[model samples]
Target chain A: MALPGFLRRERIVARPGFNRWLIPPAALAVHLCIGQAYATSVYKAALVEDFGTSQTAIGIVFSIAIVMLGLSAALFGTWVDRNGPRAAMFTSACFWVSGFLVGGLGIETGQLWLLYLGYGVLGGIGLGIGYISPVSTLIKWFPDRPGLATGMAIMGFGGGALIASPLSRQLMSYYDPAYDGTAGTVPNGDAVAALFFTLGAVYLVFMMFGAFIVRVPAEGWRPDGFDPSTVKQKALVTTESVSAKNAVKTPQFWLLWTVLFCNVTAGIGILEQASPMIQDFFRTGDSSTVAATAAAGFVGVLSLFNMAGRFAWSTTSDFIGRKPIYMVYLGGGLVLYVLLATVGSSATWLFVLLAAVIISFYGGGFATIPAYLRDLFGTYQVGAIHGRLLTAWSAAGVAGPLIVNSVLDTQGEPGSLVAANYRPALFIMVGLLAVGFVANLLVRPVASKWHEPHSDAATTPTPARSAAR
Target chain B: MSTSVSKDPTPNGQQPVHTPAALIAFAWTLVGVPLAYGLYQTIKTASTLFTG
Candidate 1:
């Protein structure tokens, strides 16, 4: 299918002297908007009350969106690559905004399935497409510092929730004066619906601004003084191109996939039950010393670490190679989990510190993988390959929560469960991280057979390289 | 074979478009303010975990 003239890749190529710095903010715009997916808990209770549904039913809405994020990224990744960022961003904006509108209608009309269809399925597609659209472009423009460039953008994904959580609360409070987003004060359904519409409108403007301003670096463009030979010297940083099709055939892809799954699984073990897990861990007989307010604060602290780690650890990959970074994220993470499992309950500060670092590694794992893929697969079809790789995220999303939740369930009921009950689940995560550490250790360069036949560097050859030829 | 590409640095031969420093600052401000707001709010909320 042909893209419209305005959205064509060729139309948006940068002219000489165009600033590459503009691209990261454009990527941030889209990511910050879709990052709202993480803030659904703000209105989750209201949705449950409005529909008189189980918490599980309300929770499925988020699960479906996450599942769709993985699936659509896998499916539409190639189309995004073919059409370019503008078209993909525009398409994502349409779906994402429409999702809010449709979900609002569902809330107003009292239809749960409409919420699922609109927010889960439609909005999820937006998440997938929006996530990967700017990444490869950033990699292309910042080949000298791909990790830093990609990290700056993916950091926005972590930061989005930070913005959306508070913004949603304030907006909900504005719409319903009685609701203060406190423990007992759930916003009414209508207020929640209105909040969705307002967010959708605001996000559409930001995402469209991103789409309008975003441009691909022109072919053969390189920052004036960059030395590609310096990058070539980095271990496992491939100069050869590999198609998305062939990427799946390599063991390196699966190894990294395992690495990501374990990292995410361990992280989600903390994230999924962050609030309750803290309370449960510190429980003293019938009553826990930790207040609900404090638990909420714990979650907020974790978000800060998660966001900071995306930028910090991923940029650190530029100095230390990608493989070594994974060794830190997974290997160091192994010890963190054991500490979190064993002695975390001994002190409140100790517990919070361990969980925060674990979540940071989790966020770092996400931001660094794109650069790792660039290292092994080269830039050709990297976005597509990234989209495919997110399926591991979707899988781990389900598996992580299940492992923790089920273990907790078997141990005892939710409110009554104490620190000892969680040890099994935390130990399980420790094992998973050990598996991921080995997988990271096993990552080797893509074999020559997998390289595209025309695997010239994906960018145009330099004048010097051309002269040598 | 020498791979196919335009030897001309700017493919369309357009004049180099100089992006003003102010424009870059404005663009950064547009995204930065909101992110800053979020960080402030989260920090304020998270303060309770320690203080309480």
Candidate 2:
């Protein structure tokens, strides 16, 4: 006898390889586009020189962008769940491209507000949407390898800066002909305009590639060679399916949010002022000029670590469980921050090593969280949940820069960053990481109320239906 | 043709069901334009932010 309609639907859903290979390319495209955020620091000197703006004023642009990223993610996440990844990604691409075009025009015209509107508002929305597009889709497609899948995608996000940093620098050099061999002085006018227009065109193509390649697997799809029984073998958190609405109500979501917030804040503290921070730390009176150049390279090097950590540490979470991995991220990160605060300039190598490790954990936290959600919430509406969770990153992006820049600005030191000046901020980062560690420990298995059990008819076994196989 | 028929079985032990092209096209249409627009905006936003 033929199987029931529901059973047939379930079986069809279970079919594997709904374009698994497509996930990586989609993720890389999005990351490459969004990764431009990393290159913001490169433009800071130019902005300061051209418009004669203070670092604080320029810093506000990034802060606004970060805030908007979080806000837009929280707002659009629900729509993403309802409409699917394609819609969210598409919307992300539009806002991102528009933000660039407008911001470019603003630069040419010297309208700071227009720059804020384009880059901060429009670009921020793109960041949020593009950020979440491939995460949940990869998880669903690679249920047997959720950590690996999500890690690959998230790693792309971290590493995107590696490519973007160089590309932006090159573009700035090419466009800005008066590039005196200064570390942070690029004259801004038509050259800036041309650069913006070019990036806008290129990124539009890349982000659209990601959006086009994105596809939801037919429902209930599982890896072809995988067994559902293996869920019992893995130490990973694995929950039955839950809607995004219900997932948010659980304490686990809040705890994870705190963890992400803390991780991002700690990392941003170093990231936002890396060049200047290094220059200050290593300054020995007459050695300041050499120190500044070295500092820029240090900033670039951190980007490498940030990118590598996103893949290495997060991929490791597949074997060791997300909760435990996060424990290391937070706990180990706390100790590193303490070392940074206490050792000061005397322990220069230690400081660099510790900073690199902490930043990696920060990047890893972003890469791993999607898989973490997949384990705790199931694939039902993970994309939306991931989007909602990213608000924490948005918060951190603002808080991180504010803490670092505000502290330094108050000190009013234009030349170099002294060890004594950074102590308070280092301590704050340490405290944040400690709190995140506690939150990770508090995370419990998801309660049963959230599971969307497959409908009874869908779960029933077919009778003498060998023909369908 | 006989071999192919022998290897494949319809769910009801009869002819296979095929999803219509128009339905697929409609679904794509619902998603395609919005996605394209988002990409455009992302590029526009980033370029403007950095350049401006």
Candidate 3:
């Protein structure tokens, strides 16, 4: 009935004085491995040439993965809450690395569906389970600093792309030295396949570190000095917990869903268009004032902001309360987007600075949401609630781009568009942020009807620690 | 139950146990080194945009 002792639940829960600090790194390993989802563009160009497919076609692979990420997370979330971190992490590791292996085989044999099946369907499932595995556990361990703890782990997701993109490029080049990853040059498809295999193996090792190292806190194990009473004093913070299935029925959960969806949509609007948007904003004659290399660098800087915001802003939320933290994201993002559309062309530095902060809020939105859930629902089913909430991300992943790209498409060619062309999309994003700001305002405490009988993890039994101070 | 309880610290409270500090360090290094390398590569690439 029980899983093997190696994978048993009892084996992994941290006893008192077990150094609560260790848990973040465990969560980071899984996130960093899976966060490579962002760096898909590194191989996107090569895949197009290899399959003789259109850019749109190769891009579907990533879109499929994101959708599946939302799907699997929602579906498997309760299982994760039930089974504990080790099982969820191990399952995630298997699906994640296997997605690569299968995709690599698909490349070796030249089957596009196989690649989708491998990377999209399977890998996306990995992404989902991997994403939420450590979340609830961290919140439980660091009830005092839930935002900072979850932020450190989720920040790893943003950093994953920074590591993966350059590493993917290097591996591709290694497989075929002649493949300089330039326009009109094709990467050796076999080399690309081998790169997939190598990446699969590498990520497997890294993800296993998370699978092995992760532990839930022993029941009733509060931090050395944390008092449980102060947690109840915060007006918006809930002492009552809600199950994930029941959480969906509450308006607070849905409102927060809208908040995350709007925040992600606004951020993705700029992120999806970063390279081209910058070029279009500052174009003069046939030459762009911002060079292609510089545009790429602009993305790299935004990536850093994205990573930094995940840690920085989310940590800030621990002190500022989650709702007010979101106000800054929504309200401040509106001003920044309007500035980008209105006077962004006057100065490149102005545009860059505005976009970076907005993107940071975008990253901040992802990192902070779990703690937000922990605040509303308590730790009992927070991970599952977080999983269900990520459906908002999947929705935004589709809608954010659709709104931006569809508007821009109607305007003109990508490289040829003027700053004026982006005005409609920017205005639309302002409206979305406004909607998000209102939603964050409306998020009251979860109503009493939906709450579980107990306020916290009364269900989880506290085990004996070997050495309590 | 009595076998190890005598050696356990804080018999009055929940006893504290830890994964070896060395093991925690080694495991962290396993993921940290790759992340550091990734950041290095990203910065290097981004720098070309600034300095180029």
Candidate 4:
């Protein structure tokens, strides 16, 4: 908790002729201002007609802010690894601007449990410490491209919902002139409490300019002519460290947490029914045949293939390695979920090109699992084992939208369903990409009784690896 | 670590890469003017659902 004095930690490092690409735009100015949690479905139909409620109580305020962003990134991931990223980006910009100033005084005092204790448990502990505070200071100043410096700050959490869903529909059409964010208008609720107090004072000045331009890499900062033994001769790349409580007593951290819970439960069975499963897989009956502005142009081409596969397949997992980039994301996501369950009703640009390459391997398995936990546990508790592997993305965001909305609500709704009622939820999302291709073919290495016994570079030496650089 | 590093490096030890042009036009309009106004409101509602 040191910071103050022009955000200390030695005037945010990089001084030696600065510019380590100015720390990926200061970690994309705090992940495109807390990737406005995928533009909270542009304020879920104005918080269900301004608190009239039920759309499952406004989808339990984004499922309690994604289960408090996986229980405050597994309970303050080792206090943002022993207080660092500028005191965890200034305590995540004061609990994400006091969770939008107590959720805009709980929507100007109507109070749905103080907007579920201000934006679901203090803005899910400011989206779990501003999402692992500048991810271990960009994997310690890009230790020679830690998966393209954590895929340029997890492609600013998919370009913060393409800049907060058209800037929250032009700030709720300039504070509601009888509202307009579609569906039979009306909901103003004091213009969504002045658009959650102008998105909590513009994400507290963009997460205090990513906590005063974050820093951290000093001890033997390598880069020039890298040569970490040519990335420790690739395959199962490790230098060894471990410790997020012995990385949850490894089996290579529960096989990379069941390979990121079966690749985010098979790309959240097509991002929780993308715009009514492409207008219920191309309707064709009494009325509909894909409209609502072409299912919002197929959810804007699946958010440009989930922000171009979080920086093109996590910068091609730094020249193909992180377990063959999860063997091309679970064996090319089990042939794009059996070509969207047998030729996804054969069209609509072949089911929008196999659900945009299975949502770009579900945003390149969350920007390549912290450089595959910094190549099997090393960069000392890779942002606390990527904050305990985002509790397998809050258990695949409640088991991939309850296995695709309870198998397309027991084969019905979605404009009187068809495509063989989403072929049994696309064959249970191809048996969750064949159980994330056998947990990325059982990832190995981290054995020597969970390393860290003083950075065990084979029972340490060289004056404790030159006093750990 | 050299009084918390910075302030030297060049005589072979790297670290000079700069990037000024007003910090690359404020980090490319801080993540490109909201991805160019979200791809101009998703290609103006996807060019009337792909020209038709």
* Residue range A1-469, candidate 1, lDDT tens digits: 7878999999998766677888888899898889889889989999999999999999999999999999999998888888899999999999999889999989989999999999999999999999999999889878888889899999999889999999999999999999987789999999999998999999999999899989887666677567777777878999888888899889999999999999999999999999998999899888888998999999999999999999999999999989999999998999998998889999999999999999999999999999999999998899999999999999999999999988988998789998889999999999999999999999998999998776356445633211100
User: Model 2, range A1-469, lDDT digits (tens) per residue?
Assistant: 4433432323333122133555566666777678787667657777766667787777677778877888877777767666666666677888888988998998888888888899988898888888887777678667777777787777666656555555666677788777743554675666666777888898888777666656665543444455567775655456467888898899999999999999989998988767677656666763543344456556655766787788888889888888999998899989988887778466556666777787888788888898888878877789889888988998888788778878777776667457777888889898899899999999887888777777866455332222110
Q: What is the lDDT of residue A177 in candidate 2?
A: 70
Per-model lDDT: 0.89, 0.71, 0.87, 0.77
Model 3, A260-374: lDDT tens per residue? 9999999999999998988898888678878888888888989999999999999999999999999999999999888888999998889889999999999999999999999
lDDT of 4 by residue, A157-274 (tens): 7877777787887787789877666656754777778888898898788778767766675555655556577877877888767889988988888888888988888888888787
The candidate maximizing lDDT is 1
Model 4 has how many clashing residue pairs? 0
Native contacts present in candidate 3, fraction: 0.54
TM-score of chain B of each: 0.73, 0.58, 0.65, 0.32
Candidate with best DockQ:
3
Every candidate's fraction of true contacts kept comes to: 0.61, 0.00, 0.54, 0.33
Query: Which ranking of candidates, highest TM-score first?
Result: 1, 3, 2, 4
lDDT of 1 at A263: 96
DockQ of each: 0.36, 0.04, 0.37, 0.14
**i-RMS, each model, one decimal:** 8.4, 11.3, 6.6, 9.4
Clashing pairs in 3: A465-B15, A466-B15, A467-B15, A467-B16, A468-B15, A468-B16
